[model samples]
Target chain A: MIERIESFRRRRPRLLEERVTLAHGAGGKASAALVDAVFVEAFRNPLLEPLCDGAVIDLPGGERLVISTDSFVVQPRTFPGGSIGQLAVHGTANDLAVSGAVPQWISAAFVLEEGFPIAELKQIAADMAAAAAETGVQIVTGDTKVVPKGAADGVFVTTTGVGVIPAGRDLSARSVRPGDKVLLSGSMGDHGMAVMLARGDLAIEADIRSDTASVSPLVESLLAAAPSTRWLRDATRGGVGTVCNELAQACGLGVLLDEEKLPVRPMVAGACELLGIDPLYVANEGKIVAVVAAEETEAAIAALRSHPLGADAAEVGEILEEPAQTVVVRTGFGGTRIVDMLVGDPLPRIC
Target chain B: MIERIESFRRRRPRLLEERVTLAHGAGGKASAALVDAVFVEAFRNPLLEPLCDGAVIDLPGGERLVISTDSFVVQPRTFPGGSIGQLAVHGTANDLAVSGAVPQWISAAFVLEEGFPIAELKQIAADMAAAAAETGVQIVTGDTKVVPKGAADGVFVTTTGVGVIPAGRDLSARSVRPGDKVLLSGSMGDHGMAVMLARGDLAIEADIRSDTASVSPLVESLLAAAPSTRWLRDATRGGVGTVCNELAQACGLGVLLDEEKLPVRPMVAGACELLGIDPLYVANEGKIVAVVAAEETEAAIAALRSHPLGADAAEVGEILEEPAQTVVVRTGFGGTRIVDMLVGDPLPRIC
Candidate 1:
């Protein structure tokens, strides 16, 4: 059903629900529908048409810059490995980094609920500052707003980042070819499982921490080694499966993955299996899915493995020409099945 | 006390509250204390030291860019003159404009409640699009996150804008001199009073609508006519009185205001008097406070009056050399009193 860009823009979104649900923000089919129908249709412009993780703009002075924004509303505020503040910084910076830009400056906006403790707010701010410092970006400007008690959760942080794209470096999903190989930075489902366990609702438990981190170092190393990489995307809310599906749809190609080759930590796999969830659909904050030229696979994997964040990097998939706009997975039992975008929110507020 | 920039940085914020209150977000003394103690102290850097509405960055290629962010949490998403969506766009864009930049791009982040109606969201998006188009800015990148029903009120939008600042132009509150004149673009207290009445909590009502609008045209006209303008700021939270107080503190000079010349709509004045609130401390969305060289006062006022939004533009005050960092108002009865930053929020979620 996915074809040329013009046809996609001309297609009207068909939403059946009158009220928004959690599914609409789960970074899956429902989320795409909401964004395309409500936002893309209203703010349709050439710059925003691609719906990439970030928007790339050509300045009047012949320079290119990338801008990305994300809001952190993760439950619990402080997760196992990261707080909303750190996620607020890393999440937006990763968008710019994966877009082949050097993230530089960030703007933070906070929505605080009245009666929230000042001590906790201090810890969050310190975490944000440390994250920004580690990511090599500055929080240059910000705003704060407070609502009455119960109007909002403890606190919500929204960060926007801007970075300059190096000349002659263009990364896009539309460049994926049949022979392009898919590489994942590391294990999946850790972030989602960790957050779920942190919520303390599920009785089943194992030691799993959210991989909330900046993937800039990994991205820089991969780009340096595999200059012919076609595209890169940080596997966030919907994880590797959703990202592959989006790539297939964008390029009118197919993605074929080997389940055995996919990287998943033992604890995360066990938690997902017990919960009846698919590891491929669970979120990972520090992982990236990259498409590279077939010949560059070895070099890319080696470069990724050199970084601590990508120690378990693996080549798990490849592009196909037969089944356009689809993702297929080869089961370890010598069977194959088509994987689709998540229909409902199996795990909400994973990020 | 504000003799040198370094001294301000060395002076630590003294906050007595153990928990954040509504005053911490009211753009007043408590808010300043919180920002200085928590954010400024944690993220101390040269770019963020001034605490300007926006941060100005010099790109590697020598081009100057201004970035600003603001979050909208108005209790009633839909108000008289505009909705939260429009305010999200206009508010951030005005910050860039007052910083002498042409707002070009905006990134919007929405924190939504689970059960918000899709129809309302569509309307809000439409309003945002219209406002961006009218303000000559584009909503280039965006994100949406949904929380469970009670986790958030309805919808909160955080917008960050990037703009280009023309060369040979610099605006800072520290440039004010003893004889510099203060000019206000239009009437005050309309926005806060209108929002207060919109809540239906008060029995007294008037025909006062919010003066929410884009002040880019007015700012441009004033700057073009009077190139010697020292600084400019939009009177948003805490109103014109608070803005003047900030200027006084920043420049280490006293502000002397002529109350008789301060423009106020009859309905707004009546509402403020009935509610025992000072019109000077109430918020205004479209008004601008400008400090200009004494010799160019007439030109500045004339330019401001030329715009429809500035029809009530008036020269209401002047900078003083005595009683440094203080703001004193000469009442119509030949008496004077100190005008301080708002102590607490009289109108919460007024946008």
Candidate 2:
């Protein structure tokens, strides 16, 4: 772990930007740079050194705790199939779930614009309550603050979730081995496409709904079937491509994706094509990417397919021994292309 | 506990406004009404029924954990004595401290507006690191999101803190008895006045600084000296007056404050007078109001006085057996007046 931290420090690039841009929050290279250079350096500690979706801590009493925090700023507040309230709860809970923990409690804080509608706020709160109930977590504490009219958009929610990791259930990206297979749950780009269409900024339309649901159930089934799972992550923000890059960087290895095996809904693919965006780099809220031992690949796919949220789960990629710290895709056209972490924003505030 | 919950439900007023107002976030009557009517009712559960600053959970392992969340949206980002970064850490940590817990870990979520300066962000993060270090807490996990320029203020931070409750420590507002004495740690309104002055909206100026420091040390010393302490709360948001009102409402009793005994810095008092606001209803970050058994009043004051942050510790009030749910102040002019929870926005975004 010390060596990993040292390597991470060595790889961090110097930040030269004088001002923040949309790229800084795009969950791509700029976001990673900001977090690595500013936050990780300032709050350096062993518990945070992993740079995992959630921070894991071992209590003096032998209890393992996982905690994660996320702030939701999706545009329009209301989007197809979901609202910020539901997304906020699922977002934090999914982080814990991916870390091999069962989310138990959550704290929500809301920042509201002065003239925002109270009815909308109540509806958002209701959505949050419903999501918490379905996710089997309790909203135990919260805070609310209001800014002047122009100081904020309609509403923003920040949720922090606490979960407990079961014994013998240690999963991490660093555990990835040479022949690990990457399994993805469901299709890609549905969430980002739905939110973009909901904004009505584009003339083109599609029958897409944001796949914004808690992935805990799918995670539990997968882990139960494939006990040797190396790593798991919810493909949010910068989507599957970004998550793959992170996994490769953490393990000091490379990843190879078979484009023919990737899952994508027709509507999402069309929308991405029309917008000149790659579905692989779009955000996802309900989907997860899992790396499992090659021997357990069939069992992992079977377990995920049995879950309702993972009906489309498939083996999409494999971990590579060569070209350390890079991600390459084997295109259907019999060619290979390097897929790097997203550099600029094609769609902002999608999640 | 059921009866308390029932009473809370009975007293909650209907929310009639169609839109949220600045007063709704002023940490006063409107804020309480919105929380009770919207959040409490939606997220109703036993753990959140008490409406304490932090929620205390008893783990199956015989360990007690307390969690609290707060959002800081103070205007200007930087203020006299502290930046929003420092205030964010202190605010959440203080919540856990007042709940008789030792703050151990914190998670921060930042929402940054596009085009914000990177240097300012670095300074803010540094301030947060300093505050966390001073309070002996670790920032283990965090997330960041960026919004367009007009969508949000410069920076808004939401922090969630987790702490552990020591063995045999059970402090609660419901434990307040009629004869319990109230002890204040330090001066009131310093933080509020300082922030307001820093905004430069008023021509009147004074050498006042925000008292935005963690109150954990003061709480520890007071609890050590007064083992029978009933309740502890920081004077934030709606200030000491609102805290007293909440105590009276929670315990079904009355609070009697001696105006002359309340500690107020000369500058803060003068500024409040000029602004036509009462110091008792203004905010303070580093101050605490403690409810202790009558017999331990002197010991509690002595313990507080020994701490640098609590040098102005004094016995300012006592619990009353009559006039349930009322807070009255006995003025130096030999008259008594009801000190109701603030009704309007005398100070918005003061925290």
Candidate 3:
């Protein structure tokens, strides 16, 4: 069986490169291809078939379990508004939350550089604890490993979260249909810009803070009000453009986004313009993209708006039947243009 | 309530060092201090109180879940008998297995350095898949992050596993008694020596292979034969000595080991002798130290020896009532000496 699986995997598309590039981790086409050719092809299973934000496991007693893991290697360990520790917790928790699960237990593993500051490590743990507490989750288990001084940056944290999905709350892109409403939880580009400014390599300054936060509360509210929501996703590494492109491809439908309806803060928009980057491609740590039934759009938006994290929520797009497996953006100037996943991220290691 | 927990945690011990040292991750006294002051104090919760290899969580419907996370940062990505990927899978699975749980699913998160070899990454994924398949477990989900070449080592894989405990089975240090017998599953020092030789830093070489295979089958067999087993632990990072010391401390009992009965292969013994290191302090990736009731020792040893992974199983020690919270070895030369956890590992990054 192992030999058969290996042979089957080898017949798939090859990565065709000696070394991995930044593009392979950009959460775009190259990233998808790498994962497909390497991991998914080798470890194929029914639970991973959907390629959703998290894998849902059916228990013996009619309960559903959701599990997700994420590794954070963000440069400049500490940035405006949050640190890597907090991001590690929120990232995994958000994955579970968007999958319609109530985030519960999390396990953290840390790889630290030999000479990393002990004070900073403590601060990171404190940040993680605070975030987990606020989200009503527990950091149940953890492991720590230290490497030689030059072997690692400062610290990298990997967090795995487990949650229980409420009965009758299945969410997946396969459930999306034409005319479904696409909603944005809040503004974009804050996290990317904040990390860039923190790096101080661009000689540009901005007073933007990362929107790194837990979106579980907002998700609970939205699910309670709009139980028929088709799907939900967090726009983290690849931002909104990549998310919409993935959804379009996964659902085998077209997504028509309106640029005028995009919730972009003025400062974030100005920063992206200055950096020669598209706001749509910048990461947002504390945002969600939801597809709801057209009739339930009002309830979804209203429920999201009641939360502090979703105060700026807006209906930014709609699913379409034409131009299958693609994302098209309607510009403020009344022209439509295709928005493909960026070949590579403009700001690497932003999250 | 959250504020109260945070405030209470703040009054615990502090990590008073300016920078982290190798000792902080050595799985010794310093490591314990670091974990207590930083992580345990911050993330205190009922599920983590045992501080065992894995955390056991009770579900709403009387089902028990075991979860564990570990990050592999071995210097040589591929050692003689296993690669980091295999170790990542087996390490996490063994944690769940030893906790008397049926290993079910795992999630892997990887942080790869930009420019790392794609072939190596593919090989790692293949190894992980094979290990998971052999263990009857699934790699349900994963995340990948890439850091700039200089910011990270070649690659680091963190695996988190989840499993369900079978009914009528309970294992913990608290279940250990003064009359319990300690058994070593197989030979020691193979993994640590193999990794050291693979590094090629030392002038000596040996034909030692790492014992980095899954022990879940062996564990299940033992449980079937001796349902009264008190505790099971894998002697991984800090080896059997550290595990015995921890068990002794946790159970408030003393352990007395017969040095002549330790199951160490001749090659590993010779290598350790040449390197001036004790086999007891060397890591073993696939070996386990099980404590069972005195009456069940025969059944436990018989069951372990029947398994391929535990062909060299031996009863090496016994728990004692006197000299609590310590380990003493009865040397072959007719004397006894205390065997405490090392101040720091002689071989760092051995996994």
Candidate 4:
């Protein structure tokens, strides 16, 4: 390996601006060059220097902070609709958003399962940089670790984000009340279904795609309009059922869902039915479930509908006082059954 | 999968506490039970209950904070001197120590390559819990991700540590001065050589053991005595050569090492000679390189020698201004040659 690097140093090519290579993931000269030329060059800032393993940021205003870390193991490395790179940025931003914090900094750690193509890694890095810029967050620090071929499956990313919540903003599952209305931001189960369809037995491609996105700004606006928004959860792993169940556990209340009023795309619904999977147990990367005071339901829904990613927003259910700790879904056949928390992750590795 | 869990739930015996099976890493019922009955039972703390991806702790006093992350992927999983679990703890804690930080909370994430023996996993977890207790640092939160068989090599551990340093106690590479003395906390390259010997490559066994340990207390003592300590770096990946070269670059100074004065165990020396690798480039998990003011050189050495992990501490060399940014090793024959950083890692996956 040292001999190879020595040979490269002797050549010292002039085409400094090109796609990345495996050497970039190596913690050596080539890797340093890659960082200097691409990530740091594009996202020029004092914070990203001679980068530290992690960044030390002082809150602009002294307040309790929000911190989140997520790891993305999305297979295929790159897929239709979105790549793992974009998913990392959006996933982290959404974490901060739901916590009612305006995210300020992010740390990206890439674990490249060896044999992953360099061009693809570079593309992923570029996507991450662009996504960070778009979301108004700084990719302040990063660490790259490369495992030998076969030790890792493909490319896995672990991103850590820090955000600051404005003082006086109270958002928690504990704050949710029995009469609060549940508002879902956009179509459900698109993200997980898209990835599954992209990977497996789907003979025909569908219009449905992963609705992965950053919702910090959208969340801020909604919370601003409806300060009484009791609770918010990004419908991620285990989909709506998981978040609702956690909320139920948190608030000590039950939820009753009107299945006829729930929004599900035809393609997603059909795919779930064919796969013998319940859409409720699937995951969604961008959709969020907001439990708000009934008086502010309209304003919350309006805020969600205004965002492009939330156009299909709808009021699906409301918190209930009776049937403690159980979620009953009212079906179109005048029958009702429990909408329990997902037993386990059915659509595994959706993130 | 859900049925499997339900069956386990219905017929569950009193917490399968004795033998471990593959299900422990399966992210299912067994895994959750393992965490509950064992890890939680042993390391129970309120901060760990939330079970976020990692722990978020606010430093007690208002001072600059230090944070670091490391991954441990060792072959044979456990060896003569250390296990992957111990390495994970020492690797991350040392990162904090060398950075002039008083290590605090740590988050340990495990990625188990499938088919890892359950007994081995339990032992590894026990090793980690014990190590954390010894160091007085809490493993506040954790995550476990399981990959199918052949997806990972045994189990890989990634730990992130957060520490805090007093505001004025700055330790920087550039702080090294012309007359500064360099100190080693312990014997060099034992970790690498021990692992190499354990790899079953030699006609004769080398009685080497890994110097894997936490260097925080040692570093603190050294700093306390030599309050004007210029810099500190763990002699780990890429070893002494890489660290010296890095210091030269950052400090804009040259470092000259008297090869005769440098310390290396005879067993390790024989192994390095046999493998045609330089001991200077071999890794050390517990050892540290401290650059201290010449006036406090004796005090620093005494400080180091007091720590159990630093009984073999020695002053190896001194910082010099001639030919700034170069590392020269003085051979016994009165000849000198540049000791450059290993361009790429000499032993791939050595860590």
How accurate locally, in lDDT, is each candidate? Answer: 0.86, 0.87, 0.85, 0.68
Flag regions of model 2 displaced more than 4 Å.
A1-10, A45-53, B1-10, B45-54
Candidate 1 lDDT tens digits, A1-351: 111122234333367788889998888888877887788778876545543434788877777888889999998888789888889999999998998999998988999999999999999999999999889998887888999999999899999999988888888876789999999999998888889899999998688889999999899999999999998988888878888887787777889999999999999999898999999999989999999999999999999999999999999999999699889999999999999877789888876
Ranking by DockQ: 2, 1, 3, 4
Residue range A190-306, candidate 3, lDDT tens digits: 898899889988877778999999999999999999989998989987789988887887677999999999999998898888888998988889999999999999999999999
Best by lDDT: 2
From the highest lDDT down, the ranking of the candidates is 2, 1, 3, 4
Residues A1-351 of candidate 4: C-alpha lDDT, one tens digit per residue: 111122223333232434333223222234334323322222223332312211222332355455556667676556668888988898877877887878766656555565555456656777776677778875544444556777777767776676667778767766778889998887778888889888866685787788888888779888988899987878876678656766665566888888877888999999888878877767787888899999999999998888887788899999999777667888999999987656434555577
- Point out where model 4 deviates above 4 Å: A1-63, B1-63
What lDDT tens digits, residue by residue, belong to model 2 across residues B219-274? 99999999999989898988999888877877889999999999998988888888
TM-score of chain A of each: 0.95, 0.96, 0.94, 0.81
Q: Per-residue lDDT tens digits of candidate 1, residues B8-110? A: 3433347889998999899877778888778877887664555343478887777789988999998688778988888989998898889889888898999
**Between the candidate structures 2 and 3, which one is better when assessed by TM-score?**
2
Off by more than 4 A, model 3:
A1-16, A45-53, B1-16, B45-54
In the predicted model 2, the residue pairs found to clash are none
Scanning candidate 4 chain A in windows of ten residues, the lowest lDDT window is: A1-10
TM per model? 0.96, 0.97, 0.95, 0.79
Clashing pairs in 3: none
In model 2, chain B matches the true chain B with a TM-score of 0.96
